[model samples]
Target chain A: MKLIMNLMASILLSVPAFIASVHAETAVIVSLDNKNTYTSIDKELVARIFLAKVTKFPDGTTAKPVNLKQGHYLREGFNRDFLSKTESQLSRYWSRLRFSGKASLPKEVNTVEEMKLAVANDQSLIGYIDAMDVDDTIKVVHKY
Target chain B: MRIGSIIGSVLAAVLVTTTVQANSGDLNIYGFMSVGVGILDKNEVTIEDFEGEGNFKQDTVLGIQVSKQVNDNTTATGQLVSRGSSDFKTEAAWAFISYQTSTDLTARMGRLRIPFFYYSEFLEVGYAYNWVRLPSDVYNIPFSSFDGVDFTQRFSIGSLDNSIQVNYGRLNDELTIFDENYQSDLKNMAGISLTSTYGDWGFRIAGQRTEMTLDTEVDEAYVSAVQVATIAQMTHSANPTPQSGVDLQAAASALAEAEVVFVEQRRIDQGQTGAILLAQQMNLDLEVQDEFAFDGHVADFYNAAITFDNGNYSFIGEVTAIEYESGLLVDNRAWLASFAKRWGDTTTHLTYSTSRDVLNSGDSGKLQEALNLQGEDKSVTLGLRYDYDVNTALKVEAQYHDEIMNRGVEGDYAMLYSFAVDVIF
Candidate 1:
């Protein structure tokens, strides 16, 4: 009975950790060259850049934002966690801005590999990918 | 037909160009289509004659946008919209080029929407907003777009995000007023707007001003009456008669005869017997000279709005005022309050709006009375929106309009029900 109770307690404690691992981890990334220039970024700045509200980096360089194609898990996770918006909400927001001729939506890539490649090649480009996909070529500015 | 063909050619060109340029740079094509069926409980709300039945053209609209990023710093965009209210006439909604001047500033020049209200940018895109239609009380501006240049600056203070926009523009268009087509021109149109967001709360304030001129043809009857009144007053002042009342009666009879002949001639020329009957029934007293002209008129519009959203629930309140230093238009004030709650894929909302005219009592005679009769309008709307897919929504709404006052006449209460499908691609 004592052994069974300890097993149940351990299983209950591990449930959240297990669930967390099952959900894909996502991170905001930039070119490795920007790693030194922008060591870290706050959530507001990231949100603004992704939303096309802020077009420049903290160091006053033009920022090119990239987005993942719709229905991508990593993109959805990043939008929900960092921007506090759903895909539908973001689509509506962009529609208003785009139709008004005020702003344009970010460029979208099909896969995480393409995202990483694009970000790695362009110093101004900012994008996001799975946390596990982060490599030395691209820097992770934020993790979610 | 001309507008439609122009839009079609533009769309074809955009499609071909986007396809050809897809591999080189960023070229995006997006569109939204909305169709609604509305039925009024009574014939009180008449729009160009048809009333009291189901109508499909009241809220149907389609808009397509094409954007090309010339480079990292510049973009060109064009949008075409076909509106049912305008009989499915396609027009260029916006055509502009935007340049990112700095990290925080963007400048755009071309034909752009006049940011008159919070929803001005997306007024025709039903999917972007929860309401089947934005409150008509505050959104009833005569014009929606202008050829302009605008600059937007974005900044932040602590936790708050802020954007300020300044615009200069001009508008020249022809519109129908009181059953007569008039050429309207607004020059030196200038506007400024500020928006701020903190956490779940948002605030906005905007103001605009323009110098206007309107040229319209006045009713012959009105012109005759004014002339007769002037001549009669002059004759009485110049030469007093023992039978002055008799002379005045004879002048009034002549004026009435002239009015009758004018109405008869109009009926023959226009073949609008129903309009003539309605005008007579409503006792319309037109108050202008033969060639009605207004020049050097200044108009000012101001608005403020506040909103709060916490994912599942949201609330918005807005107030607007319009002041016109002109003889043809009355000052106006309007306000709206709305609340919505989202549950799962469905959201329900309720809104109440009201508007009133500010009459200029200084003017006497028929004009003052006409302005005074522009009484209050109020409405309550309940709506539901269901996101059926990633980029499509289905909505149903019911609106109740209280008794409305228009053109020296009072309208009865009206209830309108609508169902709409909104899709984005």
Candidate 2:
């Protein structure tokens, strides 16, 4: 009886955590040293910045957007949920923009650690991290 | 052409070497390739050379692009593209320098794609669109690029993002028209385009005007038409052929009688008169001269497009119209509407397109038919695109053209089928 009760309790506790893992939140981040007069940003502005439609922040400073390498889960989640674009669609958009000489693909990092480090060092760079992985070195402007 | 092929090979080799050597640098290299096979039910060659037998030479293409960031606000880009339809002859498609003037303004100068259609900028990149190819009816144009300078200004109005682009250019090159080579020059070319987007809906409209000159081939039909007109003018002198003299007299009398009847009919039909009647009287001439030559004539082009895409389903409607002040190339309008649905990794699309020659010469009956130099096309296409991976796509398309009219000859129907594999790296 005791073994069965313990097993049931553990399963009940892990179900929520499993769901949470599947639906992990993503945090759009900036560097801690940045003082661009932004405590939080809107999704539309984020989309525009990443798409290269707007090259500057509200403070009139150049905004350099960074991205994770292709096929990264965090990148995929950020693209779909935040940018509202699938991988194929995003790639197609970039292909059009790049070939037209209108825009270039954002710089890319290989891993989440690298992404965090890159953003923490460059005041102009904007990046994203998994919500749970957010640290003091980065400032989360928005989460989704 | 041979030199161009050598350069293309060198570029390809450089691309391969660079890919193997580096992934992090200021200099960036990009490439795209498509291999295709297509066949048509008719023996005649259509655009892209789809004929009776399956062939792989028409749709195969390879492109390489290299771009270097010259500064924080300036970039230099160069591109080379080779097409199998042109016997795999490579060409430098674009070489340009761009500067970001402001957060929402950019200026570029050098070789640039002619922004005549919605897909003009990225027309060679098959992986950018869902179709195996763009609809031919609306995208038909002889030239694709020009030496130009352009400025783009982007702004927002409420919730809508808008942009306006202005360009000035010139095109001087050798081109093939009607299977005959001609020295073509388009001078004083200028254009403006406006594009706007609101959520899932997108809109664009553009207009361009230019003065053009071309060395046209003198064919037998033109010679015969000139001879007939010359004979009609000299009917009072000795005639070479009695039958032609009598025929000309008969035609003249018939035209006079028809003109009288047309005046009465016009009075009854639209109640139009004065200048309209004079215009109608001018159409009684049996033959028009200089109708096929395009020497120092002004031409205009206009296009409008509306698009909607909400993730899984999309729709597009576009129309293009052209008018030449004087030429055998009559005014024409072409339009297309397409719908696509995506399920998982596959997308299916259906499109309907049509084009017709608009007679502005005021000619009627057989005269109008004789002067029609282009074919009228109405087609329906069904296509499927499968995402093999993030960097590759496989596509199959079938297009059925119905009741196509070339000059005065009408063809029943033609079916073309094609398959392509496109990859980008």
Candidate 3:
């Protein structure tokens, strides 16, 4: 009886914590050595950068935005909260722009770790990952 | 020429595959396809081949585009599109070199899509919009592309994102009107479009002017009408002549006693009332033929559109009008309104559209009725689009046309059902 009660308590206590982790805040990050002089960015600028509407950052440095692959959960959250677009909406938008030769899609990485590596290796690149994954090699510019 | 088209398509495919396989640097390749089958309950055709029987050749299309960054500020791009309606022949839809002067301005030269409508540039890309096909009432212009130079400037006003495009171009191609082919030439073409977006609302307006000419063949009905009228006039007039008086001058001179023959021959050639009054009574306008055939006439086109899109729901409305200085051709106006809602992976859309020709009061109006070119129709369509995957979609649509003007004949109400699978890579 005691053993069963302990298992039930543990599961009840950990379930909400697991749910919280899954819905954790997303952090938009830049390289520690990023050339552009900006401590933080607004959601509109982030949306513009990710959409490839603006090729340069506020300070006029060429900005290269990176994206996590299609099915990444953190990427989905970031797209919804920061860009205010759904995956399908973004897909259609990018299709029009890319096929018309007006703009190209941002470089896509397969995993959050790869996203971190890509942004850290290129000072011009900006990407996002889970807040818990933020590290010293990258600077968190915005959170949602 | 058919062999050349085949060879060109083969070469384009080979090049695309080789470049993609090699993973060439700074070279990007993309492709899209939509394979559709449609059938109508009525005997009249709607979209090229959607007649009484099921047809797959009208809406099926494939397109491939390639772009390379030529330098820091320039890019080279080319697109090839194949349509089943044309027996799967491939054509270069766009081939241009774009130079970015600034982050806000871009200039491109070469063959480009005519900026006549909001969706003109990506008209063939099925996945770009919500419809199985765009409404023909607003999109069935004879010309699609022109060899040209265009300047696009992007800026913002308040919270609205704005883009202004100015283009100068010319198109020389074969056009099919009334199921007959004519060599069409559009020169001195100039157009401008402005698009503005604020949050979920979008608006666009455009205008274009061009010098248009068509090499048209003489209508047999017109010839017969003139012949019958002339015979009736010569035989029953004050000074009667034989039925064989093919020579208008001789017949007119036979009426010399009436002093009408002294009128200038130039007046007859100009289609004045004296010589062709009987022809006009017979519902034939020889004047229109004299005014427009093989002669350059000025034309103007106008378009306006508004769109609203949120995550789950969207609405669009568009209107277009065309006018010609010489009223030989139909001056048409078209409009469409559409609403769509998304439920999970499926989107349901409802659309209503209509088009009609503006009839005038003179020889132009008689010509319009005589040729039976006064097109007037309306339709309503319901469709569902299912996103099977991130890059692929499946769509099914049913269109109910209250009236369909097919080749100048009014067709009764009919239902057209179609399905399409669209994909991009």
- Best of the candidates, lDDT: 3
DockQ metric for all predictions: 0.53, 0.53, 0.50
Indicate which candidate wins on TM-score.
1
- Tens-digit per-residue lDDT, A8-127, candidate 1: 999999985686688776778899887434454777788878877666777767787899999988888887887777777777778777777766678899999999999999988999
Q: Candidate 1, residues B1-425: lDDT per residue as tens digits?
A: 99999999999999999888766657778899999888888865753222679888878999998888898679888889998877888877789888986657889999888888899877899998898777887888777888889999998776688899999999888655544455788899999999988877889999999987765334556454646665776788788786765677778887777667656442112222222323343465433321113465788999999998766788999999998765456678999999999887888999999888777553222453433335568889999999897799999988888757765467667888889999999
lDDT of 2 by residue, B302-359 (tens): 9999999877899999999999775456678999999999887899999999988776
Q: How many clashes (backbone atoms < 3 Å, residues ≥3 apart in a chain or on different chains) does model 3 have?
A: 0
Which portions of model 1 show Cα errors greater than 4 Å? A1-22, A35-39, B1-22, B47-50, B178-180, B217-254, B260-293, B364-367, B370-373
- TM-score (chain B only), all candidates: 0.81, 0.79, 0.82
Q: Deviation in angstroms for A15 in model 1?
A: 12
lDDT, candidate 2, A1-144, per-residue tens = 999999999999998688668797778888887776445467777887887766666666677899999999989888887777788878877988888877899999998899999999988899888877888889888777
Q: Candidate 1 vs candidate 3: which has greater lDDT?
A: 3
Quick one: RMSD of model 3?
A: 8.8
Clashing pairs in 2: none
Q: Is candidate 2 or candidate 3 better by DockQ?
A: 2
Off by over 4 Å in 2: A1-20, A33-40, B1-24, B44-48, B217-292, B361-368
Candidate 1 chain B, run of 10 with poorest lDDT: B266-275
TM-score (C-alpha, index-matched) for candidate 1:
0.83
> How well does candidate 3 score on lDDT at residue B318?
96
**How close is each model in CA RMSD to the real structure?**
8.4, 9.8, 8.8
lDDT, candidate 1, residue B5? 100
Per-prediction TM-score to the true structure, in the order listed? 0.83, 0.81, 0.82
